[model samples]
Target: MEKIIIIGAGLVGSLQALYLAKKGHTVEVYERRNDIRKQKLVAGRSINLALSNRGWKALKRVGINTVVEKTAIPMYGRIIHDTEGNTTYQPYGLEKEAIYSVSRGGLNQLLIEEADKLENVSFFFEHRCLDIDVESNTIIFENDTREIEVKGDRIFATDGAFSAIRARLQKRDRFNYQQFYLPHGYKELTIPAGENGSFLIEKNALHIWPRGNYMLIALGNNDGSFTCTLFFPFEGEYSFESLKTEDEIDNFFKNVFPDAYELIPNLSKEYQENPTASLVTVRCEPWNYEDKVLLMGDASHAIVPFYGQGMNSGFEDCSIFDDILEDNNLDFNKAIPEFAKTRKKDADAISELALRNFIEMRDLVADESFLLRKKIEKKIFEKHPNKWMPLYSQVTFSHIPYSEALNNGLKQEKIMDKIMAKPNIESLWDSQEVEDEILSLSANA
Candidate 1:
C-alpha cells in the first residue's frame, strides 16, 4: 500500500483522503481548521451547495452515496422571482433527475465521520501545512498544540483556492497562474422561517431573482429557511462601496429587490454588516509538482459560483482521478501525469463557461433573444433526445466532458439564433437541414 498524505479537510480534501484510503493506501489528512463537528460554526451563510449527478457519482465512488443522499434536498427546477414577486418555474430536466441542495458543512462532517471509521485513515485537525519537500515527499505542519512532520510516498494537496502548498510549488516550478477577478461580488443574507417552521418559497426549486447586470440566488435549507447570495459589482457609481450606509442598502433593495427585502427582516443591517466576497476564476497548468505531489479542487482550478458547478466539478475531479488510477493499474507515475494532461482542457473550458453563464444568469435569462433560442433548443431536444441535450443538462446532470458541453452549447446557440428569427421551429428542424447543421459541428468536435 502507498503512504498518502492529504492536506486540507474541506469537501475536496476529505474526498481525496477517503478515495485514497479505499484504494488500500494508508491515508492521513492534515487540516488547518479546527474539527468542524467539535466547533461552533456560524449559520445562515453559503451553508449549502447545489449537488448534482457529477458529485453524486463521486460520493458513490467512496461508498458515501446513501449518507449524502439522506442529507440532500432535491431541486428539480429553478423558481424565478421577478421584481413584482411573481414566480415562474423553469424545469431543469424533463425527467426526475434533479440537482440537490445539501448543507456543505453537514456533508463535510459526514465524510469525516465515515473516513474516521476506516482503520487505515487518520485525521489531524489544526495541523496547518507549512511546507512540502516534493523530492523527499515530506510535509511540515504547525499549530500551538503540536509541531509535526510526516513523510509519505505521495502527497495530495486539496487545500482550497488560496492554497499554501500551491503557492510554495509555484515558486519552484514554471507554473503559470492567473486569477481573473469578476466585477461581481457576493454577500450572504438569510430568509428566516415562518413561526411554525415552514419554507416561504417552494422548498423544492432553486430560487433566483435575476436582476439585470446583477442577481440574487437562494437555496432551501432543511431548517425551513433559505440562504441567499446577492451578486453585485464591486465598484461603480451605485456599487456596494458606493452604497456606504445602511439606508442606501435598504433603498437599493427596496427599489430593485423589493420581494427579497420583504422576506429578510434584517436586510439593511445584514447588508451593512456582512462581508462582500469577491468572485474570481483561478487557472493553473500541470496541477502537479514532480511525480510525488498533486493538487485537486480549488487548489488547481476555482471557478465562479454562477454555474453552481464549483463543488460538482471538484467531485468530478475525484471521479476522474479514480478512473485514471484504476485504468493505469494504480501507478501514480503514469496516472498523475496522464490525468493532468487530459483534465487541463476540461478544467479550463468549465472556468470559461462558468464565467459566461454569469452573463446568461444575470442578463440573458431575461433577454427575449436568449429565451427564444432556448425555446428552439428545447424543441430540438424533444426531437433529437439522444443527440442533443441542453448544455445545462449535459453539464449538471450527465458525466459529459466540460469542454464538449461548452463547445456544443456555443454551436447550438448560433443555430438557435437562426431558429429564433424564423419564428417557426419546424422550418429549422426540417430533418435534412437541422441534422446537417448540428452533425457537421458534432463530427468536427
Candidate 2:
C-alpha cells in the first residue's frame, strides 16, 4: 500500500481520505484548523452548502450517504420573495427531485468521524502546512510548538481555495494559475425557529429575495432555524458599504426584503457581527506534479458558490480520481496525469457556469422574461426528455460531464431564444408548434 499524505481535513480532504483508506493505502490527513467535531463552530462563518446528486454519488460510493442524509434538509424548489412581500415557487426539476441543504461544518465532522473508523485513516488536526518539496515528496507542517517535515509516496492537496501547496507550486516554472475575486461579498445571518421550534418560512424550499444588484438566500436547518446569506457588492449605492448604521441596515432590508427582515429579529445585529467574506474563483493547470502531489477539489478549481457545486464538484473529484485509478490499474504515474488532463476541462466549464448562474440567481430569477424562458424550457424537456435536458438538471441532477452540459445549455439557449421570438410565444409556450420547433431546432443543431 502507498503512504499517502492528504492536506486540509475539510470536506474534500476527509472524503478523499476515506476513498484512499478503503483502497488499503495508509492515509494521514493534516488539517490546519482545530477538530470541528469537538468545538463549537463560529456562528457567522458557517455557510450551509447544497448537497446535490454529484455529492450524493460520491458519498454513496463510500456507503456513508445515509449518515450525511440524516442532517440534510431537502429543498425541493426556490421560494422567491418579491419586494411587495409576495412569493413565487419555482421547482428545481420536473419531478420531486431536490437538493439537500447540509451544514458545511456538520458534514465535515461526519466525514471525519467516518474516516476515523477506518484503521488505515489517521487525522492530525491543527497542523498547518507551511510548504512542500514536490520533487522530493516531502512536506513541512507547523503546529503550535514546532515545524516538522514528513515524507510520503504520494501527496494530495485539498487545502481549499487559498491552498499553501498550490501557492508553493505557483512559484515553480511553467505552473499556470489564476485567481479572480468577485466585487460582491457575502455575510451570513439567521432566522431562528419560531415558538416550539417551527420554521418561520417554507421549510422544504430554498428562499430567495433576488434584487437586481444583490440578493438574500435562506436554507432550512435541522434545528428549525434557517441560515440566511446576503450577497451584495462590497461598495455601491445599495451595497454592504452603504449600510453603516443599524438604521441603514434596517431601512435597506425593510425596503428590499421586508418579509425576511421581519422574520430575522436579530438581522441588524447579525449584519454588524458577521464579517463580509469575499468570493473568489480559482483556476489552475497541471493539477499533478509528477505523481508526487496532486491538487484536488477547491485547491485545483475553486469556484463561486452560485452554482451550489463548489462542494459537489470537490466531492466529484474524489469519485473521478477513483475511476482514473481503476482505469489505470492503480498506477499513480499514469492515473495522476490522466486525471488532471481529463478533469481540467470539466472544472473550467463548471467555473464559467457558476459565474453565469450567479447572474441567474441574483437578477434573472425575478425577471418575467427569464421566468418565461424557464417555463418553456421545462415544457420542452418534459416532451422531449431524450432530446432536451435543462442545463440546471444536467448540472445538478445528472452526472453528465460539465463541459457537455455547458455546450448543450448554450445551444438550448439559442433554440429557446428563437422559440420565444415567435408571435404570441407566451400564450403558445405549451403549443405543439412550439414543441415541433424545438425538436426540429435541436435535431438540426
Candidate 3:
C-alpha cells in the first residue's frame, strides 16, 4: 500500500483521505487550519454549498451519502423576487428532483470526523505547508514554531484556490497557469429565523433577487435561518463602492429588493461590516508530476461559484481519480497522468459554464424573453425527457461529463435561436410545431 500524504483537510482532502485509508493506505492529511470539530470557527464566506447529484454521487462513492442526507435541506426550485416586490417560481426539475443545501463548515467537519475514525488515517492540524520537494515526494511543514520534513510515496495537493503546492509547480518549466477574476464580488448577509425557529420565507426553495447587473440569493440552513449573499461589482455606478454609507445601502436594498430587505433586519449593518470577497477562476495544466505528486480540487482548477459546482466538481475529482486508479490496476504512474489528461477539458468546460451562468442568474432570470425561452425549454424537456434535458438539469442532476454537457448546451442554443425567431413565439412556445422544429434541428446538430 502507498503512503499517501494529502495537503489541505478541506472537504475534498478529508474525503479523499477516507477513500485511501479504506483501501489500506497509510493516509496522512495536513491542514493549515485548526480542527473544525475542536474549534469554534467564525462563519466566513462559505456561501452554503449546493449538494447536487455530482456531489451526492461522490459522497456515495465513499459510502457516506445517506448520513449526509440528514443534514441537508432540499430545495426544489428558485423563488425569484423582482424589483417591484413581485415573485416568480422556477422549478429546477420535475416535481421530485431537487438540489440540497449543505453547510460547508459542517460538512467539512463531518468528513474529517469520519476519516479520523479509521485507524490508518491521521490528521495533522495547525500544520502549515512550507514547501514541497516534488522530486522526492517530500513535504516541509511548519508546526507552531519548527519545521519538519515528511516523505511519502505520493503527495496529493488539495489545497484551495491559493494552493501553495500549485504555486511551487507554477515555477517549473512547461507548466501552464492562468487566473481570471470576475468584476463582481460577493458579501454574506443573513435573514434570521423567526420566533420558534420558523422560516421567514419559503424553506423549500432557493431565493433569488435578480437585478439588471447584480443579484441577492439565499438558501435555508438547518437552524431555520437563511444565509444570504449579495453579488455586486467592486467599483461601478451600481456597486458596493457607490453604497458607502448606511443610508445608501439601506436605500438600495429597500428600492431594488424590497421583499428581501424587509426580511433582513440587519441589512445596513451587515452590508457595512461583512467582508466583500472576490470571484476568481483559476486554471492550471499537468495536474500530476510523474506519479510522485498530484494536484486535486481547487489546486488544479477553481471555477467561479455561480454554477454551484465548485465543491461538487472537487468531490467528483476524488471519485474520478479513484475510478482511474482501479481501471489502471492501481498504478499511480498510469492513473495520475491519465486523470490529468482526460479531466482537464471537463474542468475547463465547467469554468466557462460557471462564468456564463452568472449572466443568466444575475440578469436573465428576470428578463421576459429569458423567461419565455425557459418555459419553452421546460415544456420540451417534459415532453421528451429521454431525448432532451435542460442544461441546468444535466449539469446538476446527472453524471454527464461537463465537456459533453457544454457541447450539448451549445447545440441546443443554436436550435433555440431559430425557434425563438419564429413569429409570435411568446404566444406559441408550448406548441407541437416548436417541439418538432427543435427535434429536427437537434437531429442535424
Report the candidate with higher TM-score, 1 versus 2: 2
My TM-score estimates for the predictions, one after another, are 0.94, 0.98, 0.98
Looking at model 1, report the run of 10 residues with the lowest lDDT sum.
Answer: 419-428
How high a TM-score does candidate 1 get?
Answer: 0.94
RMSD of each: 2.4, 1.1, 1.2
After superposition, candidate 3 runs with Cα above 4 Å error: 41-46
* Cα error of candidate 1 at position 98, Å: 1.3
Q: How many residue pairs clash in each candidate?
A: 0, 0, 0
Q: Put down candidate 2 lDDT per residue, 37-61, tens digits, no spaces.
A: 9977653247788999999999999
| Residue ranges of candidate 1 with Cα displaced over 4 Å | 40-43, 145-147, 423-445
